[model samples]
Target: MEHAIIIVVILTGLGAVFGLILAYANKKLALEVNPLIHVVEDVLPKGQCGACGFAGCMAYAEAVVTRPEVAPNLCIPGKDPVAKMVAELTGKAAEAVEPRIAQVRCAGSNEKATRGFKYAGVSDCVAANLMFGGDKTCKYGCLGLGTCASNCPFDAISMSEAGLPVIDPEKCTGCGKCETVCPKKVIAMMPLTARVRVNCNSRDKGQVARKACSSACIACTLCVRECPYQAVKVENNLAVVDPSVCVANNCTDAKCLAKCPTKAIRPAVLGIVPGAEDQAAVERACPSCIKTNTAAG
Candidate 1:
């Protein structure tokens, strides 16, 4: 009993000494963190979307505060308002952040796209893609499994009734999370001002692409011939639109939209139908086209 008591007292003394030593060492060896980092982080949107090229919001705050070269407008989701705040806080010149939105490049809804077989395995797109490039006949098209919708951090993407993902432009922060998570690479980031887009991703030959998905771009080149500004072209059996050329030429007539045989080229804005008689729909789809038509009339 006496020996046990002595042993306990020795252990207690050793623990007390080690505790004191660790506390002192921690204080002496600790690196002083800049309070400005916390201040910057607090001002951030706290989305942790990595739109700023950092791992998260806190990492971005640290980089922008510590590094002189990191730009204040790197936060894409925050847009101009957040850029202004970040610039004011860091004393950096604020650059305008061009707003962008996520666009699903595929128009292959379940009704339009033919299925190779029924998918019976995992719900994840990555897992499904490993099994014969998913059940879709068009390997490059969306799987309609809600992978992009599930992975989107902003909740801007939702699975439509047609078994395809629909993006809400207002809710999308252009974080590129959906684009990254898409196994088929059908999701992409587009400029918010974009007036038109090619809604197909399949590079299969015209007949094969049509067999797979009725709405697939057949690479017919009709759009190419119809476009007056040389903004559309056929590349790798797929129609590609040069938005820069379209913007520079102010080619808002959307001739490509009218000429696409499969309706592969579509208005960038969702819920707007091309050639619809509704004036509001026409304006929403292509405002500049309406203005030009009105002037001509």
Candidate 2:
């Protein structure tokens, strides 16, 4: 009985000591929840896709609270309307967030570019990119592994029947996740309001780009020369469109689009070639996506 009493006293003393230490530590370094964090989080889309460069919504919330310029509503998936809402609640400038959309820089759909060989490896594009760079003739073309589609928590992306990822402008949040994950860096964010975009990413010289992909930009500078506003410039063997300088329809002079050897430049709202079927065969790889017409040929 004496031994038992001694053991009980020891246990009680240790518990009391630990309790005091915990209490003191809690008092010294107590962290209270920020009500503004809850406010910020409430305005965000709960996709937690890390498109905003945060691990999750809560992490983004804490960061936004700490840095007001970080824009509580910069979540692309959430859209500009949601951003406006956040700005209103926070009492900050609601400088209209220019809506942005994803653009595929590669033009080598299967029909445009020939496949070197069939890819039978892992289904991920990043994985296929490790072996032989990719299955397409274009060394820098999209791998078409569907990384963009899979990463999109909003289901805004679908691999075209031809294997290229097609982002529904209505569904895309401009979260930049697709841009971040593209191993070939073919995915980019373009302003939603911008009217014209270069649909190609081939940086090769015109003759070389022509051989790799039919639709690859050759940097001929026809578009640059044609733009009355001089909004286009040939840089690094690529014809870059300055959205700030790009004036609608005026970017294409009467002669420029017709001068394109590869027909690579496209009006953002390019009406489908009359009678062009939306049902064109979809490829499993971005580079191997040849039009069904190619199989017919």
Tell me, by TM-score, which candidate is best.
1
- Residue-level lDDT of model 1, residues 1-297, one tens digit each, is 999999999999999999999999999999999998898888887778887899999999999999999999999889999899999999999889888888888888878899999999988889999999999999999888888888778788888777777888778899898888898999888887777887889999999999999989999999899788888899999988888788888765777765467878877766322111244544565556565567867
Worst 10 residues of 2 by lDDT: 273-282
TM-score per prediction, in order, is 0.89, 0.77
Q: Which residue segments of model 1 deviate by more than 4 Å?
A: 1-11, 271-297
Clashing pairs in 1: none
Judged by whole-model lDDT over C-alpha atoms, candidate 1 comes out at: 0.83
All candidates' lDDT scores? 0.83, 0.71
Q: Which run of 10 residues does model 1 get worst, by summed lDDT? A: 271-280
In angstroms, what RMSD does candidate 1 have relative to the true structure?
4.0
